[model samples]
Target: MSYDPRRPGEDKSQRAQTRERDDAQVEKAHRPDALILHEIIRREGEEEMRRTALALSLSGFSAGLTMGFSLIVPGVLKGHLPHEPWADLIVSMGYSIGFLIVVLGRQQLFTENTVTPILPLLTERTSGAFLRVVRLWSIVLVANIVATIVIASVLAHTDAFKPEVREAFAEISRHTIEDPFWTTVIKAVFAGWLIALMVWILPATGSAAPFIIILMTWLVSMCGLAHIVAGSVDAYYLVATGEIDLAKYVTGFFVPTLLGNVVGGVTLVSVLNFGQVAPDMEGQDRVGV
Candidate 1:
């Protein structure tokens, strides 16, 4: 069916409708560009910085407590699944459960702070903004760690779970402290990078947010990435059970993972993304956008 040039009126009408539909489709598919994403995250940072210490602590503690489900779910799966190696793939899906809860629930997570607060700090470039970021990070991290300690101890010392599940927790948690210092740090860097990237992506995900969170977190789990908060659950579990002492947990897992997470989340995600959008943002500033 070829176009009939003689029927100009019909052709014009069809062409106009086609153009309208195409324009609508383009608008629908337009994800927020980098500059828009930067502004969104920067505003999120500002909001976070405004939170009172008590608010941040309570939220962070909830996040940390919720993160323990990453351990519980997988331990449950590992207990129920057949002993085949492929079973780990199934178990890994459970690892995303805690992340799904935390992300969707808007809990204050520490790794998320590594990127979110950094955005405003980069934009503001003031001592006060920097101090707020430091304050937020400090309070959130400590609160998260404290919550992890509480949960891990409960998982360790309580008879809350069945023997198999407890044993599964032990089996799973031992790996966190098994790695050498540098190795754990390297793993943590990847974990932090992925988690931060997930944070950056969330603003753009819209209805797919849960899927993205689960996918990224599951990858971290499947690859055995050493996330500071999630791994803290594991590390502290080991500590609680007397499998590893406090000194060992501190020197081996805590210090290195924390350092790596900061480096990975701040340097790899926040700094790089801010650098990418800074010029455009400055242009927006000049133009009063």
Candidate 2:
């Protein structure tokens, strides 16, 4: 007679063991893959698109207010350290502090929205969806800028920080505005690309999410890339201190950085990633955790 594994009266202990092993294997097979991660983040983006305007505005304002630490921490560091070539590297690491808090806190940062909202529009491809993306962008960007302006004014007018730290802030702002227009644009592109890539990789990072955010943002700072939200604080601080005129700040830094960031996040990161997975995403109905 041929041996049959499922024969009647099979050893009970052996059957139980076999079942347990099969269950473990099944669970392992269900772990998320790269495509699944893409779907997961895409779903998240769609949900964010559906949030109320007020909700987005509040979160964005909070993010902008909180991101001041990116400058503050670095300014403090630069204040304490003696001026040297390598001091910038150490100061750049301080730049990561604000990003960690903002991202981990789940606030609506405008840079992050660049990639997140684009995903929903890509999948839906409707005029309404396109408009919604624009609405979210406009609200978040304005809210963030307003918050930055408020914070910069307070820092400039009041003794919010020590003299050394305040001077450091002015020095940082001076360097930021001193960059040529095209240089700011190009650097902002790199910043935007990196920030969007951070969003894309976040779903797959699991517990290491904070480290990734810090690393990418630190790279942005170290490379002297312009970032709209963070750079807004720098620009506004210059205006507050009378170091640079409002018109120059807006026309020279804000406009180019904003355009460059949008191009980098939407065109380079969002569009390219969507194209890579669009062919495979057709049949999936819902993707989530």
Candidate 3:
């Protein structure tokens, strides 16, 4: 060991093998990167969706109840603010809280799931799986929206809200009534896009994703973006309180917002995500490889 200078060349191949083994050991010890996490989350999402279909009604009702925060938050915040535009921002932040919970908690949210299940269908799965996903999305979405409307109406009629909250609801209702149908639809499209983006990002971020979701969704609400399920609560509140006509709320707010959300999620986020991931997909022809 002390006279190694002249023998340095003797162990060259042995040293190289030792170094290679060391490198392999190091690589094995390293934590998983984004790609691995992505796969884990993708599979998790798929499994969640499968379970969600069976529990669709309960999930839809919970989504409705949770979505009511959208109406209540703005209404509550309006009481604190002096009838100014900035008050809307405060309320919108509150609205996003419910979404953050339902989504990050891995509870079934109708809109977000629309894009997820479709990805699997793009491959060679049976047509039945594709139809099942669609059926699940449609049922959950419809039930959620209906639940929101019903709850909102009850809250409005019962005067469960404080006087200040009632005033805020009325103020918020006026804006919905005043806006043109087309504008509501457009805003809803953008809102849905943001929500879908949140869904996409969540899989990549793991447990910490709720913060990102809260931020983006708050921005969506602050910017006056519309969301179908959440917005229905506000629309129905107007009808329940006798402040706005039911027909107008249905034709104007409900129809337009729902259409906009679908367009945003499916046409924007879902399609874009598919296009980005399509090239990377390999071994598709093989069965479950």
Which candidate achieves the best lDDT against the true structure?
Answer: 1
lDDT-superior candidate, 1 or 3: 1
lDDT of 1 at 92: 92
Candidate 3 structure, TM-score to reference? 0.80
Candidates in order have lDDT scores of 0.92, 0.87, 0.73
The model with the greatest TM-score is: 1
- Residue 82, model 3, lDDT: 75
TM agreement with the true structure for every prediction: 0.92, 0.89, 0.80
Better of 2 and 3 by TM-score: 2
- lDDT (Cα) of model 2: 0.87
What is the C-alpha local distance difference test score of candidate 1?
0.92
Q: What is the C-alpha RMSD of each candidate to the true structure, in Å?
A: 3.0, 4.4, 5.8
Candidate 3's C-alpha runs over 4 A off are: 1-45, 52-54, 84-86, 283-289
Q: List the candidate 2 regions with Cα displacement exceeding 4 Å.
A: 1-31, 283-289
Flag the better candidate by TM-score, 1 or 2: 1
Model 1, range 1-289, lDDT digits (tens) per residue? 9743343565777877877777899898999988888888889889999999999999999999999999999999999888999999989999999999998999999999999999988888999999999999999999999999999999999888889999999999988888999999999999999999999989899999999999999999999989999999999999999988999989889999999999999999999999999898779789998
